[model samples]
Target chain A: MKEVTVGIDIGGTNTKFGIVDDAGTVLYQSKLPTQKHADFKDYIQELDSAIKHGLEQTSSDLQITGIGVGAPNANFYRGTIEHAPNLVWKGIIPIVDIMQKDFNVPVIITNDANAAAMGEMIYGNAKSMKDFIVITLGTGLGSGIVANGELIYGFDGFAAELGHVTVNPNGRNCGCGKVGCLETYVSATGIKRTVYKLLADHIEESELRGISFHDLSTKMITESAERGDSVAKAAFEYTGKILGSKLADSVAHTNPEAIFIFGGLSLAGDLIFAPTRKHLEANLMPIYKNKVKVLPSGLQNQSAPILGASSLVVDHLNKKSSVNI
Target chain B: MKEVTVGIDIGGTNTKFGIVDDAGTVLYQSKLPTQKHADFKDYIQELDSAIKHGLEQTSSDLQITGIGVGAPNANFYRGTIEHAPNLVWKGIIPIVDIMQKDFNVPVIITNDANAAAMGEMIYGNAKSMKDFIVITLGTGLGSGIVANGELIYGFDGFAAELGHVTVNPNGRNCGCGKVGCLETYVSATGIKRTVYKLLADHIEESELRGISFHDLSTKMITESAERGDSVAKAAFEYTGKILGSKLADSVAHTNPEAIFIFGGLSLAGDLIFAPTRKHLEANLMPIYKNKVKVLPSGLQNQSAPILGASSLVVDHLNKKSSVNI
Candidate 1:
């Protein structure tokens, strides 16, 4: 019988789940609204039912092996999600424990960025690379560090909070109650804020000037920049500069071979990668110059999240067997 | 016969070598002037003779198992010392290969800071720590990062160059050709520079005003601070603030359980520790705050360099055996 693992990605609004084989192929996949159920237990029950439904639709000869999950604020060590602001659940939720009780197979979980890093290592561009970093540029900037051929969970599970590292000591206030965080200048929301700042700083005529702060979106900014809007272009340049310079600092810490950019803003392509690479090279120390590469995530855009979450199980099983050997 | 490893620490002025057992004890130790010979081969020959002489003084039953050398710009993977500014050797010196040819035992090499970190993990305060950082505050700020209970060698052997990380974008001019590196603000030389800047900025400084930049030393600054001199005291505070804040960024990257301050500047004790700990706690993100301990190295002062170099052999053998198992 073919062995399969269930991969679940719990986002703020939607939770994506899929049945995946060891080769990272998605057999069956679906999504459920995360906020529809206020209670975490109810959400778990619905998720279980959905997964069961997905498994039934797949070939009957397939046997379940394990479950791997990716979520914001997920703790790999504790198997809990703690105080994730975007999630409806207010406090710590024992998602792994809940899943483990319902499923006979092993249940493992980590933050979305770490899951993405594991995916990269297992089935993406980093398959041959032993040391690298994955930066998820979604609503908030998230990072997962891989060193010595393993993910660095640190002393606590929350090691790679690259977003919260200060860019400016007193620049912008972050949700984490820190001022001048890297995310304040580099994430999807950060670029929007930068666009607004650019509009106020100069009298440049652009498409972004008409849109209100809440109504403005990263997609609109990307579209405007592609059409030669100075404000939108400046926003990407500014964002990339901050990201690139900070990544140079990250390089001094880990000295990774390459840094992969994942999630929403990465889709802007050269608009973001160009300035980031430029400034990163400019800011690096002489010994590190021209050595590190900044690249995009190799995972397919739509199925990337599922693939990342599912790869965790395969990685864990491989590690387990290797340790046994 | 009892098995022992030889540890060699090559410094700009002196080269220290010692015979050490697996129990972290120094069996026999001695030092020789490093820059006496113009050629690296001559230096190596002299070093080999010195080790042989020291070993002759030790118990005759001791059998050589391995040799570990710690020096500036040492590379673990290549086992070469590359472009060490302080060393007489102008280019890459294959010390490990040379030593391996002379001694029919394994020869390993890494930078002094990494050696110190291994020493910490094997016999110092970080014996039980799986994740921690060792900051060597001597001529320049050097760091060794330990994550997942292993030293981070990075893609290249030169991973933890934390001293070169930018503390200020356009601050001080560093010898490394970088502006405002962490070493410029936090190392022994950095504090001296800070003292000069403080003396220039404030007219209230009395004692340090008489001292020339070349005459000034970290020891003198510590003495003045101990004697309640405001300029010296303020220098400590300013240095601590920078070190602490930058360490907050370090914590964000690796999330170490503790950060151990080693080398010369660490000798100041509370003068450096108090302000650094306070600032480290203040600048850390909420989750990491109060979690990481800013502590002093557990290795004894005079013997630390030798111990650190020696620990590398034990660590390498242990890892090799574990992998074999």
Candidate 2:
């Protein structure tokens, strides 16, 4: 039986959908604008349309087994998208009910970080790993913790929010209204904030002098680093130092086998990797030093979110038979 | 079939053990001097004698299904006690293999903290909880993390060393050679240290000054607090404040349903509880405050270590079928 699953990776800007098979292949895919709807009903309608069109491209009769969704603030237990900052919707939206009604299949949803972790476990380099941490340092620091080959969704399906954990009590003001959060100092926006601070305080000549907040991006920082811009390079080093030390602290708690880095800031390669490794080792306990490996996510480019979402459905359905009752 | 298990809890000064049934009934129990043997093998023999006598006392010939051992620096995967600080054993001893040879029953081993956590899950307050952190604040701080209904044993089976984690980088020197560990501020020894510091600096009049470090203990501190000794009460207040804040950080990471504290320091009652609860709630995120319960261990008064250790063996043997290939 060719079990096809509808995988939706919902972002603030766009929602990407893919019709994936049981063999871990994406047979067809499409993208839709996310912010086009006021109530998000139009968004789901578009997603239904995308899945319908994608299914048509498959040669055999494609029986969509279920639906899996990955989005910011998606609550697994409630099957709803909770107060997600990026989304236009203000309150809870029952995404599962909507998706199931449209597709007539079992629907599930989880936070983006956990979905990415599942994707890595099922379809990426983390296949052989039983305990690994999937860290997505995009606009925010999102972490999906895998221990004993299962996602650690705590009592309320809210666990592994590494970004909100304090790195410094009085360091930086986080969007979460906390000070010195891991996310405040390590993510893409965090790097930009650091760069701006450096630009304002230090006397360095660089191409990013006049760039506004909207104009600047992690890509620009990477390009500047490649061109020997000391300020841009310093930003990465500072950010990575905080990240590395935080990783050491994290190791003390979970002792994960490896940490997988994915998302925007991670694309900086050595700019982020070198300093992170150095600081992580310096801060780690003697027993744990250099024991945990840092690796890049196996999914290429933008395929991660989609694959991660789909992986949830695939893994969950597989494990459903375990309950004897 | 009626099955029983032997649970052994090894401490620096003494060892306690019991024969425990499936319903958590302690059929027979005893305590013996841990210093009975200079040789590791001798200690094992003594433990064997204890277990044999305990089983014989029970009427029905219940099959001894398993043996559980808990000690400092114990390793679950290796089933060995390695270079534990207090144990006179000079090197790694495969205690599980030694025990298995005696009865041909399954044997399991874990550190003391993990055993306590297992005891909580199987026989104590956290029986209904799958996500919780059990912190033992005795001579030192020890944490056992339970996530997704299982103990999180890391790659080296040495995960959940929350005490050694840096809560403050420059605060205090820990026995682990680290600075500002949570244990250095919250454990029984840590509380006395806080009392001395308060005495030396605060210029407060108190009965605590009459006592020497040789006789001073957390028990004395609680007594002084009950007698209205300003410095002694302040020490516990200070200890609770630090512990609670550290726990708040723990909440941010694991988001556990509850944090159960056991051991001497927790015996101070509201002298420790009030400040801890206040500070924990003050520091916790809005979603976690009031939602996350910080409570004392239900097994606080009982000789839980041996029970916990015994529970480990039972839990391990119970899970054997899960890993059956």
Measured by lDDT, the strongest candidate is 1
C-alpha positional error of residue B96 in candidate 1 after TM-score superposition, expressed in Å: 1.0
Score candidate 1 by TM-score against the native. 0.98
lDDT of 1 by residue, B177-252 (tens): 8898999999989999999998888889469899999999999999999999999999999999999989999999
* Candidate 2 wrong stretches, greater than 4 Å: A204-207, A321-325, B320-325
Candidate 2 lDDT at A320 equals: 77
Clashes of each: 0, 1
Q: What are the per-residue Cα lDDT tens digits for candidate 1 across A1-325?
A: 9999888999988999999987888899999999999898999999999999888889878888899899988999999999988898999898887888899788999999999999999989999998999999988999999999999999988899999898889799898888999999999899999998999999989988789999998899999999999999999999999999999899999999999999889999999999999999988999889999899999947888888999899888989999899
DockQ for candidate 1, please give it: 0.86
